[model samples]
Target: MFWRRWCGLFLDQKRRKKSDATYKNYKHILGEFVDQLPASVRFIDQVNADVLDSHMRYLESEKAAPKTISNKMMVVSFMLKAAGVATPSKMMELPTVEEEIPEPYTREDLQALFKAMTPEERVRYTFFLDTACREKEVAHAQWADLIDGKYWVRKKTFKARGGKERQFSPKSHETRLIPLTRELMDMLNARRKSSKSQRIFPNEWGDPEGHFLRKFKAVAKEAGLNCGECETTISEGRFTKHPAEVSCLTRPVCEKHYLHRLRKTCATFWHEKHIPIRTIQSWLGHKSLETTQKYYVASAIPRIVPPPCSYSRRICSNSSTLVLLSTRSSLGAVRPEAESRVYGFQ
Candidate 1:
């Protein structure tokens, strides 16, 4: 009945090669609901809005976060729609999280952190900052992915989903090339000579590296970076050396400074160099220009405009004033054309 259709739909998603992380979450959420269903409710049609209302109450009773509750509800709604079941009336709306500007590291901060890392850690972090790559992209990268001093990130990555690992593309299924800096290129070329694993960054078992947050935070701690956000003590002032899940904890501590900050840092650097936002979006593998605009770009706009008579042309009506204005604009004077494109600034 309902159980048979659920299994069939789940298997169909797997067969069609949907994202592993997505399917895993759907399965977990759906499984919980099925288990909670009353013994009398056995048919698909029996699972209606009332049943879903009970499920919502059940999640609230368990003290689930608003975002979590919303996600679970969406998953169930999608599942029910696939099975041709009616959705609950006025279902739970998604929580509105405040949009905060991404905090990218200053050049000095980046240098200090780089200096504190070990040779291996330095190379890895340096590559991330230079390329603006996601952690999963780093995990799935192979030596063969590099060509002409650039690395190509594609769908040929092994990802963990549904309690098992399989080859798949993550995030956007689009492929992109990241150009390597000369220093980073040289460093990687040297490492490639004696590397035993096919992966660019491999675990001790010669597999794609997974969950390197502990090691990254350890390096940050040694670098004297304040990490009061991620560090939670056990009892009587005993700090946890390497917690298994750093991100799943409360308050999203990595809000200010974390590994992902490096990606944003790279984007900010490009923006500072006057690189176009569309180009930055492509390099960062963002699905839309809005994602690049909202996160990667800096919120600060410099106040460099002069008063009414600041421009040479405004002071003198002579044609030579126009030449002086052009010269001054070239020498870092306010250029309205450039400023106009930056976050709609006039």
Candidate 2:
């Protein structure tokens, strides 16, 4: 069968079982693969070792990340296998994909990001940090999903008038419950009383908001937290007919600023609070505990400690004298205070 025909068959098999995002991703990968195929290679059987190698080379030439390349290649292998062709493993070696370390946002970074957001944006992002839910899960969350002080992540189906069906489900099709803090619960209750839509957060059209990452980057830029070094080519308004390469310095397109980092930060916070790996995995709705350990449990908290001398200069720059005061407090009650003085020259 032709490459496109085989790809269609494979996608049809996946369409019913996979989530919309997964189905779209698989379709995109297969479409790209078919597009990159040589004209001579029409049938699945014509896809030999050399063809796989050439495809890998094309992916590398496009400067795709190692993990992305591996994922695409895996999809290609699946397609070939579904078509009863020999898989790439028997003929060629796959590229090694390095394990990526998760980088969660620090308290300071979170503060800056929150400071840059509006009141409405803060509430939306606060839900992200408190729940550690994926973007889609958060977007699709409804008041009905919250039951007895816990938020349930589950599959939801929407039926169209023409008998067509659309479904929204958690990643891996795993449904789990996450407990919320009292403060968050109180806030949510207030919003619930005032909200007109069924969704906890909704756009002007009363649908789940989808363009969160773009707004997040804007907040990062407004907070002056953007790295301002990364650059990419993109097309803008009608005035700019041609795509222009731009830097993050001019545009709010920093790689470091994203909604997922908030999720990672929340997971890391849970880990730091002595939460068990299995529990964290369940809260994250991960099918495997290894994912929680590999990404969240092993993530490090960013820290910066200044030298002792620098601390004095930085704290008391104008004065030659420094007084260190310590206080003991319990339950908002002050107990005692101790004072020490140090003389220093600027």
Predicted model with the maximum lDDT: 2
Model 2: lDDT equals: 0.73
Which digits, one per residue and each the tens of the lDDT, describe model 1 over residues 1-346? 6665775676477545665556777778888888888888887778766777788889889888777877788777777767766554345445444555568775445545665666788678767777878888888888998987678888874534334556747479789886665556666898899998888899887766775665675666565665455644333325655444443133223435566777877676566545567777777898988989976546342323433212111111122121112212232322211121111101
Q: Which window of ten consecutive residues has the lowest lDDT sum in model 1?
A: 337-346
Query: Global lDDT for candidate 1?
Result: 0.63
Q: How large is the C-alpha RMSD of every model relative to the true structure?
A: 11.6, 8.9
The sequence of per-residue lDDT tens digits that candidate 2 reaches over residues 162-235 is: 55576787878899888764445656897899999888988777767778888889899998898989898878
Badly placed stretches (over 4 Å) of model 2 are 12-24, 86-92, 159-164, 238-241, 296-299, 302-346
**Which residue pairs does candidate 2 place in steric collision?**
none
Clashing pairs in 1: none
RMSD of 1: 11.6
